[model samples]
Target: MEIRRLAGRVRTAIARADQKLVTFVQSHANLTTALVTAGLALWALSTHQSAIVLRMAAAGAVGYFLGLTPAVCVGALSVGFSVAISLEHGFSISNLIIEVIGAGCSAWLGYQHKMQKVRQEQAADPHAPQVLPWAVVNEIRTSLAAIRFLLFPLHDEEGSRENQALQQATQELSRLEALFREMEQRDRAGEGR
Candidate 1:
């Protein structure tokens, strides 16, 4: 009986800790999004170039939702912004095909990297539930995956942090799951008797 009570207390403690971490992640994500939106809005107002403004705004919006790799979004936006500036200054593209190819290649690379990160995170936390309504596990996985994309193909600072948080989340989730399962089993067994 004491052992069971101790296990219950431990599970409760882990659940509370996980909830706090999840809250922190959510708060940080909201802050990041707000900052991106405000920055893009300000940039849009200051830029005389309408095309550049739109590109920045779109990229910033994507970055905000991605919650990771704001740099990649910024880099992509810069490329398009530079092209726009060049066009405005009378740089003509001789081959539209080449420009399209370049844009497509960059987008493909970004997408592929994002998918690979998702796979890695999934592999790392295989037992974790994929679709829990109350748990922010999927969001955590997504954020971590995107961070992995931003950090690779090298050591990822944000990815490491995300991984740690994800592991904690999974451990907490497992504890809760086990606790509930045990309770359900006990109740069913008593009913049968």
Candidate 2:
């Protein structure tokens, strides 16, 4: 019990610290980006690290933190400085490729972040499409399917009033299922974007 309590306290402390860090980053985005970029520059220049992955990650991080403009600026700066350093030694085709790839990563990640923010804003609007929880929607669909089966035991009749009503009910259910399917597809497409 004592150990569990201590662990709980530690978890709470860690959570609080994480929240504080996120708050600071959000509130001081420019400062955070500048600081991170400066660190990246120092690390890259001092070590003369030509690791394309490192460049890409640094640029992407800065891009994800801000919007396209800052990301593009960071990408350009990083690529230009790295290329200059490479040129000082001799023109290396590999280094140029790495720099270009890093710049691309920066642009792509930044654009993604900006689009994500826009999506969040749209989701918050009442006019946006209603998105039900996927699992719950699936369960509802399953239940509807079971009810449909139960309603039409053997065969669907066209003439009898009772069967006609059941047929109409089945048609409505089918339409509802199609609607949910469409919604699911839309949700997936949105995520892929």
Candidate 3:
């Protein structure tokens, strides 16, 4: 019964955590979108300026922190803007290609960092113990609860009569059910007083 109560509380807590995760992802998306737009606007307004370069850098950093994946949209935009500026600065096309490659590598590194953090969290969070889903848990419990027969050697069955005794014991299921009801009633009455 205590485990049942704990399970109910864990279910509620997990639901709340799921909602928080959704909100967190949405907010990250919005922020990333805003940063990307700002970087593009800056690049369009001033094709060659330190301010544009700084904005591009900021966008790349934010993208790495928020995306949690390589080839993120903001990361792509950052690299795109940087390449365009390099082209405008009279850099060779090869240099622009190198910039894109560097950007890609950095994005991949950021993704790896995010994955490491996730693994660390999983290791540290004991209360978030890994378990089978509810359906699997229910199936296991059901199968165990319905286990009415135990395999026994023929000698044990006849010499000690353990198998027959176990079968007889299983027949006391109704009595156990009544005892459970009585306990429940007593608990309710105690609570009322």
lDDT of each: 0.55, 0.69, 0.58
**Candidate 3 residue pairs in clash (backbone atoms < 3 Å):** none
Residue pairs in steric clash, candidate 2? none
> Using lDDT as the measure, what is the rank order of every candidate, best first?
2, 3, 1
Clashing pairs in 1: none
Poorest lDDT segment (10 consecutive residues) of candidate 2: 32-41
Weakest 10 consecutive residues, lDDT, candidate 3? 148-157
Candidate 1 TM-score over all chains jointly: 0.26
Candidate 2 lDDT, tens digit per residue, 1-193? 9999999999999999999999997877645544544554455466666465466666677767776677778778777877777687787776566566546655665667668788899888947557688886786787677666657656655567566667767776787788878878988898798
- Per-residue alpha-carbon lDDT of candidate 3 for residues 102-154, written as tens digits (9 for 90 to 100): 44444544555567678899889855434446874675465445544333333
Scored by lDDT, model 2 comes in at 0.69
Q: What TM-score would candidate 3 get against the native?
A: 0.36
What is candidate 2's TM-score against the reference? 0.36
Reference-based lDDT, residue 49, model 1 = 40
Clash number for every model? Answer: 0, 0, 0
lDDT of 1 by residue, 1-193 (tens): 9999999999999999999999998767545544544554454456544444454444444434553365355546566666676786776453223333333333334444466578999999986443334444565466556554544434446657767755665665566567568766876796698
RMSD of each: 27.4, 12.2, 19.2
